[model samples]
Target: MSRFRYSFQKIVDLKTNEKTQAEWILSSAVNDLRVEEDQLSDLKHHKSEVQETLVSAAANRTTVSELMLYQKYLDHIDHQILNKNAAVRAAQINVEDKQSNLTAKMREEKVWSKAREKAKLHFTAALLKKDQEALDEMSVSRHKQPS
Candidate 1:
């Protein structure tokens, strides 16, 4: 009997590779989003600490210039936090896109895999049938011969 060969093995491999690449892209985007979120958290923590210091200084009769400087610094940190939030949002979107692409590639690969499995089953059935026929012929020949 002839060996079973999958006709679309190459296509399956290609789709698997594409899925791997998309997974990598998604991982990178997720990592980037995490980093941006961490930075934003740190900035917010620092702003709170500065605010507390400013309140203590005001109670201790701090100069107007110093108070103004602290307020300006707080505003700057707020702006940075806003920008970081936007960056995190953009990274999230990128990860979602990559995830979608990976899903598509995986689905394509599964289709080819199913086709290969069907072909193998058909080949096996044919081989079994051929073997059964050969056995039947040999048995009939033996019975026809002299006992």
Candidate 2:
């Protein structure tokens, strides 16, 4: 008996490769998003520390110039935080896009996998039928032989 071979094996291999590539891309995107979120968190933490310092300084006797400087620094931190927030949002969007692409690749791979399984089942059934026919012919000949 000949071995069963899937007709679309090449297509199945291509789909599997595509799914792997998509997974890699999605992982990279997720890492990027995590980095962006960490940056945003650090910025917020720094801003809070600066605010605490400004409040403590107000409790002591401070020069007008020094107060203005602290205020200016705080304003700069606010602007930086705003930019970091925007970056985090953009990273989130990129992550979502990568996830959708991965999903599409998974679906493509599944379709090919299902097709291969169906082909294997059909081949197996045909082989079984052929074997049964051969056995039936052998039985008929044996019965016709001399008792």
Candidate 3:
């Protein structure tokens, strides 16, 4: 048997809260992903600055106390950077999950649309066939001798 192929012909007819929610979810997910990426960029820039500071401190051969203070500052910056990176990663994961859900929703919508089109076509063809059958019967009866 040949595999069935389907396509949408009346996607415009569907109106439901689910479709509206899907659109909103997709838009929000995209916006959230963008914001997370921007935060990551800012965090990396800050981390780079801290690294530069550490490198300069090392090169200067500062006194022990000053070096210790610099090390503490560097450590604090590193912690903040790590925290920022973690937050960004978590946000990215959330965005990816939401995107996956959105993709599934879109697929569902496509399938539903195709099914609806097929149903419409099937009903229309059936009605046409019924009308044709009726016309054929009427013509045969009209020409037949009384019986």
Winner on TM-score between 2 and 3 is 2
- Measured against the true structure, the TM-scores of the candidates, in listed sequence, are 0.91, 0.95, 0.64
lDDT of 3 by residue, 33-87 (tens): 7787787687778768877776788788777787788778778777777877787
Q: For candidate 2, lDDT tens digit of each residue in 1-147? A: 989899889999999999999999999999999999999899899989988988888889988888889999999999999999999999999999999999999999999999999999999999999999999999999999999
Against the hidden true structure, what lDDT does model 1 obtain?
A: 0.88
* Candidate 1: tens digits of C-alpha lDDT, residues 81-133: 89988988888888888889888888887888888889899989999999999
TM-score of 2: 0.95
- Please report how far candidate 2 places residue 130 from its true position, in Å: 0.8
The C-alpha local distance difference test score for the whole of candidate 3 amounts to 0.72
Which candidate order results from sorting by lDDT in descending order? 2, 1, 3
Return the lDDT, model 2, position 122: 95
RMSD of 3: 7.0
